[model samples]
Target: MSWLVTGGAGYIGAHVVRALVDDGESVVVYDDLSTGSAERIPEGVPLVVGSVLDRSALDAAIRDNAVTGVVHIAAKKQVGESVEQPLHYYRENVTGLQTLLEAMASAGVGRLVFSSSAAVYGMPDVDLVTEDTPCLPMSPYGETKLVGEWLIAAAARAHGIRAASLRYFNVAGAAAPELSDSGVFNLIPMVFERLEAGEAPRVFGDDYATPDGTCVRDYIHVADIASAHLAAARRLADFPEGTALTPSTSDAGRAARSGRWSTASSRSPAGRTSAGHEPSVTRQVSLADRARELLGWSARHDLDDMIESAWQGWRRRHG
Candidate 1:
Protein backbone atom coordinates (compact mmCIF):
# COMPACT_ATOMS: atom_id res chain seq x y z
CA MET A 1 0.00 0.00 0.00
CA SER A 2 1.14 3.57 -0.67
CA TRP A 3 1.80 5.76 2.40
CA LEU A 4 2.16 9.50 2.79
CA VAL A 5 5.00 10.63 5.02
CA THR A 6 4.77 14.32 5.79
CA GLY A 7 8.12 15.96 6.56
CA GLY A 8 9.73 13.00 4.81
CA ALA A 9 12.94 15.02 4.31
CA GLY A 10 13.56 15.71 8.01
CA TYR A 11 15.63 13.59 10.38
CA ILE A 12 13.15 11.09 11.84
CA GLY A 13 10.79 11.35 8.86
CA ALA A 14 13.62 10.48 6.45
CA HIS A 15 14.47 7.38 8.44
CA VAL A 16 10.84 6.32 8.54
CA VAL A 17 10.67 6.65 4.77
CA ARG A 18 13.80 4.52 4.38
CA ALA A 19 12.38 1.88 6.67
CA LEU A 20 9.13 1.79 4.73
CA VAL A 21 11.02 1.46 1.46
CA ASP A 22 13.14 -1.31 2.90
CA ASP A 23 9.94 -3.08 3.90
CA GLY A 24 8.89 -3.00 0.22
CA GLU A 25 6.14 -0.46 0.82
CA SER A 26 5.46 2.17 -1.89
CA VAL A 27 5.99 5.66 -0.40
CA VAL A 28 5.36 9.32 -1.25
CA VAL A 29 7.11 12.21 0.52
CA TYR A 30 5.71 15.69 1.24
CA ASP A 31 8.03 18.29 2.70
CA ASP A 32 8.33 22.08 2.42
CA LEU A 33 12.10 21.91 3.01
CA SER A 34 12.15 24.56 5.71
CA THR A 35 14.53 22.58 7.91
CA GLY A 36 14.21 19.44 5.78
CA SER A 37 16.48 18.56 2.84
CA ALA A 38 15.25 17.12 -0.44
CA GLU A 39 18.57 15.26 -0.70
CA ARG A 40 17.60 13.26 2.38
CA ILE A 41 14.65 11.60 0.64
CA PRO A 42 15.56 8.32 -1.04
CA GLU A 43 15.60 8.50 -4.82
CA GLY A 44 12.90 5.87 -5.43
CA VAL A 45 10.09 7.55 -3.48
CA PRO A 46 7.80 10.11 -5.13
CA LEU A 47 8.55 13.53 -3.65
CA VAL A 48 6.20 16.53 -3.38
CA VAL A 49 7.58 19.87 -2.37
CA GLY A 50 4.66 21.23 -0.36
CA SER A 51 3.47 22.36 3.07
CA VAL A 52 0.76 20.74 5.25
CA LEU A 53 -0.83 24.16 5.68
CA ASP A 54 -1.81 24.08 2.01
CA ARG A 55 -5.00 22.03 1.94
CA SER A 56 -5.08 22.15 -1.84
CA ALA A 57 -1.59 20.68 -2.06
CA LEU A 58 -2.37 18.01 0.51
CA ASP A 59 -5.68 17.08 -1.12
CA ALA A 60 -3.99 16.74 -4.50
CA ALA A 61 -1.17 14.62 -3.05
CA ILE A 62 -3.63 12.31 -1.31
CA ARG A 63 -5.87 11.96 -4.37
CA ASP A 64 -2.95 11.48 -6.76
CA ASN A 65 -1.20 8.92 -4.61
CA ALA A 66 -4.39 7.15 -3.46
CA VAL A 67 -2.77 7.40 -0.06
CA THR A 68 -3.88 4.56 2.21
CA GLY A 69 -2.56 6.13 5.40
CA VAL A 70 -0.52 9.03 6.71
CA VAL A 71 2.36 9.37 9.10
CA HIS A 72 2.30 13.03 10.15
CA ILE A 73 5.81 14.09 11.23
CA ALA A 74 5.92 17.71 10.10
CA ALA A 75 6.19 20.50 12.68
CA LYS A 76 8.48 23.17 14.14
CA LYS A 77 10.11 21.43 17.12
CA GLN A 78 12.68 23.61 18.83
CA VAL A 79 11.86 24.01 22.54
CA GLY A 80 13.81 27.22 23.21
CA GLU A 81 12.71 28.67 19.89
CA SER A 82 9.08 27.77 20.54
CA VAL A 83 9.22 29.74 23.79
CA GLU A 84 10.53 32.71 21.83
CA GLN A 85 7.79 32.48 19.16
CA PRO A 86 4.62 30.99 20.56
CA LEU A 87 2.29 32.27 17.82
CA HIS A 88 4.33 30.70 15.06
CA TYR A 89 4.41 27.51 17.07
CA TYR A 90 0.62 27.43 17.37
CA ARG A 91 0.13 28.28 13.71
CA GLU A 92 2.53 25.62 12.44
CA ASN A 93 1.86 22.89 14.96
CA VAL A 94 -1.82 23.41 15.78
CA THR A 95 -3.37 25.22 12.82
CA GLY A 96 -1.35 23.20 10.37
CA LEU A 97 -2.81 20.06 11.98
CA GLN A 98 -6.28 21.46 11.40
CA THR A 99 -5.50 21.88 7.72
CA LEU A 100 -4.11 18.34 7.42
CA LEU A 101 -7.11 16.74 9.13
CA GLU A 102 -9.58 18.58 6.94
CA ALA A 103 -7.71 17.53 3.84
CA MET A 104 -7.55 13.94 5.08
CA ALA A 105 -11.32 13.96 5.57
CA SER A 106 -11.89 15.41 2.14
CA ALA A 107 -9.62 12.79 0.61
CA GLY A 108 -11.23 9.90 2.60
CA VAL A 109 -7.96 8.82 4.27
CA GLY A 110 -8.57 7.85 7.90
CA ARG A 111 -5.60 6.12 9.47
CA LEU A 112 -2.84 8.33 10.90
CA VAL A 113 0.24 8.00 13.06
CA PHE A 114 1.02 11.28 14.78
CA SER A 115 4.59 12.11 15.77
CA SER A 116 4.07 13.14 19.36
CA SER A 117 6.69 13.73 22.10
CA ALA A 118 7.65 12.85 25.63
CA ALA A 119 7.82 16.61 25.98
CA VAL A 120 4.02 16.33 26.30
CA TYR A 121 4.77 15.14 29.80
CA GLY A 122 6.92 18.28 30.26
CA MET A 123 9.38 17.26 32.92
CA PRO A 124 7.17 14.82 34.74
CA ASP A 125 7.18 14.71 38.52
CA VAL A 126 8.38 11.14 38.25
CA ASP A 127 11.31 10.00 36.12
CA LEU A 128 9.58 7.22 34.16
CA VAL A 129 6.39 8.48 32.50
CA THR A 130 3.49 6.40 31.27
CA GLU A 131 0.94 7.34 28.60
CA ASP A 132 -1.41 8.25 31.41
CA THR A 133 0.96 10.92 32.73
CA PRO A 134 -0.57 14.36 33.13
CA CYS A 135 0.52 16.73 30.37
CA LEU A 136 2.03 19.73 32.12
CA PRO A 137 4.16 21.27 29.40
CA MET A 138 6.66 23.85 30.63
CA SER A 139 7.47 25.28 27.19
CA PRO A 140 5.48 26.38 24.20
CA TYR A 141 6.80 23.45 22.17
CA GLY A 142 5.40 20.97 24.68
CA GLU A 143 2.13 22.85 25.00
CA THR A 144 1.56 22.78 21.25
CA LYS A 145 2.24 19.05 21.15
CA LEU A 146 -0.36 18.45 23.85
CA VAL A 147 -2.84 20.57 21.92
CA GLY A 148 -2.01 18.72 18.69
CA GLU A 149 -2.86 15.36 20.24
CA TRP A 150 -6.17 16.77 21.47
CA LEU A 151 -6.94 18.11 18.03
CA ILE A 152 -6.18 14.74 16.49
CA ALA A 153 -8.54 13.09 18.96
CA ALA A 154 -11.26 15.56 18.12
CA ALA A 155 -10.74 15.07 14.39
CA ALA A 156 -10.86 11.31 14.75
CA ARG A 157 -14.20 11.50 16.57
CA ALA A 158 -15.70 13.90 14.08
CA HIS A 159 -14.24 12.34 10.94
CA GLY A 160 -14.07 8.53 11.29
CA ILE A 161 -10.25 8.49 11.49
CA ARG A 162 -8.14 6.36 13.80
CA ALA A 163 -4.73 7.58 14.97
CA ALA A 164 -1.74 6.51 16.99
CA SER A 165 0.12 9.33 18.69
CA LEU A 166 3.54 7.86 19.41
CA ARG A 167 4.89 9.84 22.36
CA TYR A 168 8.58 9.68 21.50
CA PHE A 169 11.47 10.61 23.75
CA ASN A 170 14.95 11.67 22.60
CA VAL A 171 15.28 9.96 19.19
CA ALA A 172 18.91 9.40 18.12
CA GLY A 173 21.04 7.42 15.62
CA ALA A 174 21.07 7.12 11.80
CA ALA A 175 19.52 4.67 9.31
CA ALA A 176 21.72 4.85 6.17
CA PRO A 177 24.25 6.97 4.23
CA GLU A 178 21.44 8.82 2.45
CA LEU A 179 19.78 9.62 5.76
CA SER A 180 19.91 13.22 7.03
CA ASP A 181 22.03 14.49 9.88
CA SER A 182 20.32 14.93 13.24
CA GLY A 183 18.79 18.38 13.50
CA VAL A 184 20.62 21.10 15.49
CA PHE A 185 17.65 21.16 17.87
CA ASN A 186 18.32 17.67 19.29
CA LEU A 187 20.95 17.25 22.03
CA ILE A 188 22.69 14.08 20.77
CA PRO A 189 23.52 15.65 17.41
CA MET A 190 24.57 18.85 19.08
CA VAL A 191 26.90 16.87 21.32
CA PHE A 192 28.27 14.91 18.38
CA GLU A 193 28.78 18.11 16.41
CA ARG A 194 30.58 19.79 19.29
CA LEU A 195 32.79 16.73 19.78
CA GLU A 196 33.53 16.69 16.05
CA ALA A 197 34.69 20.27 16.46
CA GLY A 198 37.18 18.97 19.09
CA GLU A 199 35.24 20.19 22.06
CA ALA A 200 33.61 18.43 25.02
CA PRO A 201 29.88 18.89 24.81
CA ARG A 202 28.81 20.99 27.75
CA VAL A 203 26.72 19.33 30.43
CA PHE A 204 23.85 21.59 31.46
CA GLY A 205 23.12 20.88 35.14
CA ASP A 206 25.09 18.55 37.41
CA ASP A 207 23.02 18.97 40.54
CA TYR A 208 19.75 17.37 39.53
CA ALA A 209 17.96 14.97 41.86
CA THR A 210 18.88 11.86 39.90
CA PRO A 211 21.39 9.35 41.18
CA ASP A 212 24.04 10.70 38.83
CA GLY A 213 23.19 14.29 39.76
CA THR A 214 22.38 14.98 36.08
CA CYS A 215 18.98 14.93 34.39
CA VAL A 216 18.07 11.52 33.06
CA ARG A 217 15.83 10.99 29.99
CA ASP A 218 14.51 8.16 27.85
CA TYR A 219 16.83 8.10 24.83
CA ILE A 220 15.09 6.09 22.08
CA HIS A 221 16.94 4.96 18.97
CA VAL A 222 15.48 6.17 15.65
CA ALA A 223 15.25 2.73 14.03
CA ASP A 224 13.16 1.49 16.93
CA ILE A 225 10.86 4.46 16.53
CA ALA A 226 10.39 3.67 12.84
CA SER A 227 9.57 0.07 13.64
CA ALA A 228 6.85 1.21 16.02
CA HIS A 229 5.29 3.39 13.32
CA LEU A 230 5.27 0.49 10.87
CA ALA A 231 3.72 -1.74 13.44
CA ALA A 232 1.03 0.83 14.12
CA ALA A 233 0.40 1.17 10.40
CA ARG A 234 0.06 -2.55 9.84
CA ARG A 235 -2.33 -2.81 12.74
CA LEU A 236 -4.45 -0.05 11.26
CA ALA A 237 -4.50 -1.74 7.88
CA ASP A 238 -5.72 -4.97 9.44
CA PHE A 239 -8.49 -3.48 11.56
CA PRO A 240 -11.56 -5.74 11.85
CA GLU A 241 -13.96 -5.04 9.00
CA GLY A 242 -16.84 -2.56 9.36
CA THR A 243 -15.98 -0.98 12.66
CA ALA A 244 -18.13 2.16 12.80
CA LEU A 245 -15.76 4.19 14.96
CA THR A 246 -15.27 7.83 13.91
CA PRO A 247 -12.09 9.85 14.49
CA SER A 248 -13.12 10.43 18.09
CA THR A 249 -12.20 6.85 18.83
CA SER A 250 -9.53 7.03 21.50
CA ASP A 251 -6.09 5.61 20.72
CA ALA A 252 -7.27 2.68 22.84
CA GLY A 253 -10.00 1.95 20.29
CA ARG A 254 -8.26 1.28 16.97
CA ALA A 255 -4.56 0.55 17.60
CA ALA A 256 -1.92 -0.19 20.22
CA ARG A 257 -3.92 -2.28 22.64
CA SER A 258 -0.80 -2.92 24.75
CA GLY A 259 2.82 -1.76 25.02
CA ARG A 260 6.33 -3.17 25.54
CA TRP A 261 8.97 -1.30 27.53
CA SER A 262 12.69 -2.07 27.88
CA THR A 263 15.38 0.02 29.51
CA ALA A 264 19.14 0.04 29.02
CA SER A 265 20.88 -0.47 32.30
CA SER A 266 21.84 2.79 33.97
CA ARG A 267 25.55 3.50 34.39
CA SER A 268 26.85 2.42 37.73
CA PRO A 269 26.07 5.02 40.34
CA ALA A 270 29.79 4.76 41.10
CA GLY A 271 30.60 6.37 37.73
CA ARG A 272 29.08 9.65 38.96
CA THR A 273 32.46 11.36 39.08
CA SER A 274 35.65 11.58 37.06
CA ALA A 275 38.94 12.56 38.71
CA GLY A 276 38.00 16.20 38.03
CA HIS A 277 34.72 15.72 39.93
CA GLU A 278 32.38 16.31 37.01
CA PRO A 279 29.22 14.27 37.21
CA SER A 280 29.00 11.43 34.73
CA VAL A 281 26.57 12.46 32.03
CA THR A 282 24.00 9.80 31.16
CA ARG A 283 20.37 9.38 30.05
CA GLN A 284 17.95 6.69 31.17
CA VAL A 285 17.20 3.80 28.87
CA SER A 286 13.59 3.80 27.63
CA LEU A 287 11.55 0.96 29.02
CA ALA A 288 9.76 -0.10 25.82
CA ASP A 289 6.50 -0.83 27.60
CA ARG A 290 4.02 0.73 25.13
CA ALA A 291 5.89 -0.21 21.97
CA ARG A 292 6.21 -3.82 23.02
CA GLU A 293 2.70 -4.32 24.33
CA LEU A 294 0.62 -2.10 22.00
CA LEU A 295 2.51 -2.34 18.75
CA GLY A 296 4.52 -5.53 19.42
CA TRP A 297 7.71 -3.41 19.31
CA SER A 298 11.00 -3.45 21.22
CA ALA A 299 14.27 -1.57 20.86
CA ARG A 300 17.30 -3.31 19.40
CA HIS A 301 19.91 -0.62 20.23
CA ASP A 302 21.00 0.16 23.77
CA LEU A 303 22.62 3.41 24.89
CA ASP A 304 26.25 2.24 24.70
CA ASP A 305 25.65 0.71 21.27
CA MET A 306 23.86 3.81 20.00
CA ILE A 307 26.60 6.12 21.23
CA GLU A 308 29.28 3.99 19.59
CA SER A 309 27.43 3.93 16.27
CA ALA A 310 26.75 7.70 16.37
CA TRP A 311 30.38 8.45 17.16
CA GLN A 312 31.52 6.09 14.43
CA GLY A 313 29.25 7.78 11.89
CA TRP A 314 30.42 11.23 12.97
CA ARG A 315 34.08 10.23 12.74
CA ARG A 316 33.68 8.61 9.33
CA ARG A 317 31.80 11.61 7.96
CA HIS A 318 33.91 14.37 9.53
CA GLY A 319 37.33 12.84 10.14
Candidate 2:
Protein backbone atom coordinates (compact mmCIF):
# COMPACT_ATOMS: atom_id res chain seq x y z
CA MET A 1 0.00 0.00 0.00
CA SER A 2 1.21 3.51 -0.73
CA TRP A 3 1.55 6.04 2.08
CA LEU A 4 0.88 9.74 1.67
CA VAL A 5 2.96 11.70 4.13
CA THR A 6 1.87 15.30 4.52
CA GLY A 7 4.71 17.69 5.44
CA GLY A 8 7.11 14.91 4.57
CA ALA A 9 9.92 17.40 3.95
CA GLY A 10 9.86 18.82 7.48
CA TYR A 11 11.92 17.57 10.42
CA ILE A 12 9.78 14.80 11.96
CA GLY A 13 7.95 13.99 8.73
CA ALA A 14 11.23 13.73 6.85
CA HIS A 15 12.48 11.18 9.35
CA VAL A 16 9.22 9.23 9.05
CA VAL A 17 9.60 9.20 5.26
CA ARG A 18 13.15 7.92 5.54
CA ALA A 19 12.09 5.22 7.96
CA LEU A 20 9.22 4.13 5.70
CA VAL A 21 11.50 4.04 2.65
CA ASP A 22 14.11 2.03 4.57
CA ASP A 23 11.41 -0.48 5.49
CA GLY A 24 10.61 -0.94 1.78
CA GLU A 25 7.40 1.05 1.87
CA SER A 26 6.28 3.28 -1.02
CA VAL A 27 5.87 6.94 -0.05
CA VAL A 28 4.42 10.05 -1.66
CA VAL A 29 5.18 13.37 0.01
CA TYR A 30 2.81 16.38 0.14
CA ASP A 31 4.47 19.58 1.22
CA ASP A 32 4.17 23.24 0.24
CA LEU A 33 7.85 23.94 0.99
CA SER A 34 6.79 26.78 3.27
CA THR A 35 8.81 25.45 6.21
CA GLY A 36 9.75 22.16 4.58
CA SER A 37 12.85 21.85 2.41
CA ALA A 38 12.77 19.97 -0.89
CA GLU A 39 16.29 18.67 -0.23
CA ARG A 40 15.21 17.22 3.13
CA ILE A 41 13.13 14.50 1.44
CA PRO A 42 15.23 11.64 0.13
CA GLU A 43 15.73 11.59 -3.59
CA GLY A 44 13.34 9.45 -5.70
CA VAL A 45 10.32 9.77 -3.40
CA PRO A 46 7.47 11.49 -5.26
CA LEU A 47 6.65 14.97 -3.93
CA VAL A 48 3.46 16.98 -4.47
CA VAL A 49 4.26 20.60 -3.79
CA GLY A 50 0.93 21.65 -2.31
CA SER A 51 -0.80 22.54 0.95
CA VAL A 52 -3.06 20.14 2.86
CA LEU A 53 -5.65 22.92 2.99
CA ASP A 54 -6.03 22.68 -0.76
CA ARG A 55 -8.56 19.88 -1.21
CA SER A 56 -8.33 19.79 -5.00
CA ALA A 57 -4.58 19.36 -4.89
CA LEU A 58 -4.85 16.85 -2.06
CA ASP A 59 -7.53 14.83 -3.89
CA ALA A 60 -5.59 14.81 -7.13
CA ALA A 61 -2.39 13.77 -5.40
CA ILE A 62 -4.09 11.04 -3.37
CA ARG A 63 -5.89 9.71 -6.42
CA ASP A 64 -2.90 9.87 -8.78
CA ASN A 65 -0.52 8.38 -6.23
CA ALA A 66 -3.00 5.65 -5.22
CA VAL A 67 -2.33 6.62 -1.62
CA THR A 68 -4.15 4.10 0.61
CA GLY A 69 -3.03 5.52 3.92
CA VAL A 70 -2.25 9.04 5.12
CA VAL A 71 0.01 10.25 7.86
CA HIS A 72 -0.98 13.88 8.49
CA ILE A 73 1.95 15.94 9.79
CA ALA A 74 1.28 19.27 8.16
CA ALA A 75 0.39 21.90 10.77
CA LYS A 76 1.81 25.12 12.23
CA LYS A 77 3.63 23.99 15.42
CA GLN A 78 5.17 27.02 17.08
CA VAL A 79 3.47 27.67 20.43
CA GLY A 80 4.61 31.28 20.73
CA GLU A 81 3.81 31.98 17.12
CA SER A 82 0.41 30.40 17.53
CA VAL A 83 -0.20 32.71 20.47
CA GLU A 84 0.74 35.65 18.27
CA GLN A 85 -1.35 34.38 15.34
CA PRO A 86 -4.28 32.34 16.64
CA LEU A 87 -6.20 32.78 13.40
CA HIS A 88 -3.39 31.32 11.38
CA TYR A 89 -3.18 28.38 13.77
CA TYR A 90 -6.93 27.64 13.50
CA ARG A 91 -6.87 28.02 9.74
CA GLU A 92 -3.90 25.74 9.26
CA ASN A 93 -4.41 23.22 12.03
CA VAL A 94 -8.21 22.95 12.21
CA THR A 95 -9.46 23.92 8.77
CA GLY A 96 -6.60 22.05 7.21
CA LEU A 97 -7.79 18.78 8.79
CA GLN A 98 -11.35 19.36 7.60
CA THR A 99 -10.07 19.83 4.08
CA LEU A 100 -7.97 16.68 4.23
CA LEU A 101 -10.84 14.67 5.67
CA GLU A 102 -13.11 15.83 2.87
CA ALA A 103 -10.48 14.91 0.32
CA MET A 104 -9.94 11.51 1.93
CA ALA A 105 -13.67 10.76 1.80
CA SER A 106 -13.79 11.71 -1.85
CA ALA A 107 -10.71 9.64 -2.69
CA GLY A 108 -11.74 6.56 -0.64
CA VAL A 109 -8.62 6.50 1.56
CA GLY A 110 -9.89 4.81 4.74
CA ARG A 111 -6.99 4.87 7.18
CA LEU A 112 -5.07 7.74 8.76
CA VAL A 113 -2.35 8.31 11.33
CA PHE A 114 -2.34 11.81 12.78
CA SER A 115 0.63 13.47 14.46
CA SER A 116 -0.76 14.99 17.64
CA SER A 117 1.23 16.74 20.39
CA ALA A 118 1.70 16.50 24.16
CA ALA A 119 1.15 20.23 24.43
CA VAL A 120 -2.53 19.30 24.71
CA TYR A 121 -1.78 18.57 28.34
CA GLY A 122 -0.73 22.17 28.90
CA MET A 123 0.53 22.34 32.51
CA PRO A 124 -0.88 19.50 34.56
CA ASP A 125 -0.96 19.16 38.32
CA VAL A 126 0.42 15.63 38.17
CA ASP A 127 3.79 14.76 36.68
CA LEU A 128 3.07 11.37 35.08
CA VAL A 129 0.24 11.54 32.56
CA THR A 130 -1.70 8.45 31.63
CA GLU A 131 -3.91 8.28 28.52
CA ASP A 132 -6.94 9.65 30.35
CA THR A 133 -6.16 13.22 31.41
CA PRO A 134 -8.49 16.14 30.84
CA CYS A 135 -7.14 18.42 28.12
CA LEU A 136 -6.26 21.91 29.23
CA PRO A 137 -4.26 23.33 26.39
CA MET A 138 -2.52 26.62 27.12
CA SER A 139 -1.63 27.90 23.67
CA PRO A 140 -3.30 28.15 20.30
CA TYR A 141 -0.84 25.60 18.95
CA GLY A 142 -1.88 23.00 21.52
CA GLU A 143 -5.55 23.83 21.10
CA THR A 144 -5.29 23.24 17.39
CA LYS A 145 -3.70 19.85 17.89
CA LEU A 146 -6.40 18.82 20.37
CA VAL A 147 -9.05 19.96 17.96
CA GLY A 148 -7.35 18.06 15.15
CA GLU A 149 -7.58 14.85 17.15
CA TRP A 150 -11.24 15.56 17.82
CA LEU A 151 -11.84 16.05 14.12
CA ILE A 152 -10.16 12.73 13.34
CA ALA A 153 -12.42 10.98 15.82
CA ALA A 154 -15.52 12.68 14.51
CA ALA A 155 -14.68 11.88 10.92
CA ALA A 156 -13.88 8.28 11.73
CA ARG A 157 -17.18 7.73 13.52
CA ALA A 158 -19.14 9.44 10.78
CA HIS A 159 -17.32 7.97 7.77
CA GLY A 160 -16.22 4.50 8.99
CA ILE A 161 -12.53 5.34 8.59
CA ARG A 162 -9.99 4.00 11.06
CA ALA A 163 -7.43 6.34 12.60
CA ALA A 164 -4.85 6.64 15.36
CA SER A 165 -3.50 9.87 16.82
CA LEU A 166 0.12 9.74 17.99
CA ARG A 167 0.77 12.38 20.64
CA TYR A 168 4.43 13.41 20.80
CA PHE A 169 6.53 15.23 23.37
CA ASN A 170 9.77 17.09 22.81
CA VAL A 171 10.70 15.43 19.52
CA ALA A 172 14.47 15.81 19.16
CA GLY A 173 17.37 14.14 17.32
CA ALA A 174 17.99 13.46 13.64
CA ALA A 175 17.60 10.15 11.80
CA ALA A 176 19.72 10.90 8.71
CA PRO A 177 23.06 12.63 8.57
CA GLU A 178 21.91 14.85 5.73
CA LEU A 179 18.68 15.87 7.50
CA SER A 180 19.15 18.41 10.27
CA ASP A 181 16.84 21.11 11.61
CA SER A 182 18.52 24.53 11.59
CA GLY A 183 15.51 26.16 13.21
CA VAL A 184 16.12 28.35 16.23
CA PHE A 185 13.23 26.88 18.21
CA ASN A 186 13.50 23.93 20.66
CA LEU A 187 15.90 23.91 23.61
CA ILE A 188 18.34 21.08 22.95
CA PRO A 189 19.22 22.04 19.39
CA MET A 190 19.43 25.68 20.36
CA VAL A 191 21.82 24.77 23.15
CA PHE A 192 23.91 22.68 20.78
CA GLU A 193 24.03 25.39 18.16
CA ARG A 194 25.01 28.04 20.69
CA LEU A 195 27.61 25.84 22.34
CA GLU A 196 28.96 24.94 18.93
CA ALA A 197 29.36 28.63 18.22
CA GLY A 198 31.45 28.97 21.45
CA GLU A 199 28.65 30.62 23.37
CA ALA A 200 27.28 29.56 26.76
CA PRO A 201 24.18 27.45 26.40
CA ARG A 202 21.38 29.42 27.98
CA VAL A 203 19.03 27.63 30.37
CA PHE A 204 15.54 28.97 31.06
CA GLY A 205 13.63 29.23 34.38
CA ASP A 206 15.71 28.43 37.39
CA ASP A 207 13.14 29.26 40.07
CA TYR A 208 10.41 26.67 39.85
CA ALA A 209 9.76 23.99 42.49
CA THR A 210 11.94 21.32 40.93
CA PRO A 211 15.57 20.67 41.74
CA ASP A 212 16.63 22.76 38.79
CA GLY A 213 14.18 25.58 38.38
CA THR A 214 14.40 25.12 34.63
CA CYS A 215 11.36 23.31 33.28
CA VAL A 216 11.77 19.59 33.03
CA ARG A 217 10.60 17.83 29.88
CA ASP A 218 10.16 14.32 28.52
CA TYR A 219 12.37 14.28 25.46
CA ILE A 220 11.89 11.46 22.96
CA HIS A 221 14.08 10.74 19.98
CA VAL A 222 12.34 11.33 16.68
CA ALA A 223 13.15 7.81 15.49
CA ASP A 224 11.18 6.21 18.31
CA ILE A 225 8.21 8.39 17.42
CA ALA A 226 8.36 7.27 13.81
CA SER A 227 8.35 3.68 15.01
CA ALA A 228 5.24 4.40 17.07
CA HIS A 229 3.49 5.73 13.98
CA LEU A 230 4.38 2.62 12.06
CA ALA A 231 3.02 0.47 14.85
CA ALA A 232 -0.18 2.50 14.99
CA ALA A 233 -0.60 2.09 11.28
CA ARG A 234 -0.04 -1.66 11.54
CA ARG A 235 -2.42 -2.00 14.46
CA LEU A 236 -5.16 -0.21 12.58
CA ALA A 237 -4.66 -2.63 9.74
CA ASP A 238 -4.51 -5.73 11.93
CA PHE A 239 -7.48 -5.07 14.20
CA PRO A 240 -10.41 -7.26 13.38
CA GLU A 241 -13.64 -5.74 11.99
CA GLY A 242 -12.07 -2.26 12.07
CA THR A 243 -12.19 -0.25 15.29
CA ALA A 244 -13.51 3.21 14.51
CA LEU A 245 -10.81 5.37 16.17
CA THR A 246 -8.50 5.56 19.15
CA PRO A 247 -6.51 8.33 20.79
CA SER A 248 -2.73 8.16 20.98
CA THR A 249 -1.28 5.70 23.45
CA SER A 250 1.16 8.31 24.70
CA ASP A 251 0.89 9.32 28.38
CA ALA A 252 0.25 12.96 27.74
CA GLY A 253 -2.62 12.30 25.36
CA ARG A 254 -4.02 9.76 27.78
CA ALA A 255 -3.81 12.32 30.53
CA ALA A 256 -5.52 14.88 28.38
CA ARG A 257 -8.42 12.54 27.82
CA SER A 258 -8.64 11.23 31.40
CA GLY A 259 -7.52 14.24 33.40
CA ARG A 260 -4.74 12.34 35.15
CA TRP A 261 -1.46 13.81 33.99
CA SER A 262 -1.05 17.43 35.02
CA THR A 263 1.77 19.86 35.71
CA ALA A 264 3.29 22.16 33.13
CA SER A 265 5.68 25.07 32.75
CA SER A 266 6.45 27.38 29.90
CA ARG A 267 9.33 25.65 28.22
CA SER A 268 11.70 28.05 26.44
CA PRO A 269 15.38 27.92 25.51
CA ALA A 270 16.45 31.47 26.34
CA GLY A 271 16.21 30.86 30.07
CA ARG A 272 13.13 31.40 32.25
CA THR A 273 12.86 33.85 35.17
CA SER A 274 16.09 32.90 36.92
CA ALA A 275 19.42 31.81 35.43
CA GLY A 276 20.82 29.96 38.49
CA HIS A 277 18.06 27.60 39.64
CA GLU A 278 18.65 23.87 39.68
CA PRO A 279 17.43 21.72 36.79
CA SER A 280 14.07 19.99 37.19
CA VAL A 281 14.37 16.52 35.75
CA THR A 282 11.25 15.10 34.11
CA ARG A 283 9.60 12.26 36.00
CA GLN A 284 7.24 11.06 33.31
CA VAL A 285 8.32 8.02 31.29
CA SER A 286 5.27 7.84 29.02
CA LEU A 287 7.09 7.31 25.75
CA ALA A 288 9.00 4.38 27.20
CA ASP A 289 5.74 2.71 28.09
CA ARG A 290 4.44 3.41 24.60
CA ALA A 291 7.56 1.85 23.12
CA ARG A 292 6.94 -1.31 25.11
CA GLU A 293 3.19 -1.76 24.76
CA LEU A 294 2.26 -0.12 21.48
CA LEU A 295 5.13 -0.82 19.09
CA GLY A 296 7.31 -3.35 20.90
CA TRP A 297 9.81 -0.52 20.47
CA SER A 298 12.56 0.82 22.72
CA ALA A 299 14.64 3.92 22.50
CA ARG A 300 18.12 2.65 21.82
CA HIS A 301 19.57 6.13 22.22
CA ASP A 302 19.49 8.39 25.26
CA LEU A 303 19.64 12.17 25.38
CA ASP A 304 23.41 12.34 25.85
CA ASP A 305 23.96 9.86 23.05
CA MET A 306 21.62 11.78 20.78
CA ILE A 307 23.34 15.04 21.66
CA GLU A 308 26.83 13.72 21.03
CA SER A 309 25.85 12.02 17.79
CA ALA A 310 24.10 15.15 16.54
CA TRP A 311 27.06 17.28 17.57
CA GLN A 312 29.39 15.12 15.51
CA GLY A 313 26.98 15.17 12.59
CA TRP A 314 26.72 18.94 12.75
CA ARG A 315 30.51 19.21 12.77
CA ARG A 316 30.81 16.96 9.75
CA ARG A 317 28.11 18.81 7.81
CA HIS A 318 28.98 22.38 8.77
CA GLY A 319 32.61 22.49 9.85
Best candidate (score: lDDT): 2
Taking all chains together, the TM-score of candidate 1 against the true structure is 0.83
> What is the C-alpha local distance difference test score of each model?
0.69, 0.72
* Model 2 TM-score, 2 decimals: 0.86
List candidate 1 stretches off by more than 4 Å.
Answer: 180-182, 238-287, 316-319
Which candidate achieves the best TM-score against the true structure?
2
Q: What is the TM-score of each candidate against the true structure?
A: 0.83, 0.86
lDDT of model 1, residue 154? 78
191-284 per-residue lDDT for model 1 (tens digits): 6665445554555555655664555556656777787778777777555432221111111211110011111112211111213443432433
Tens-digit lDDT track for model 2 on 153-262? 88887776788887767766677656666576876556656655555455445455555434455666677677777777777776533344434433232211101111
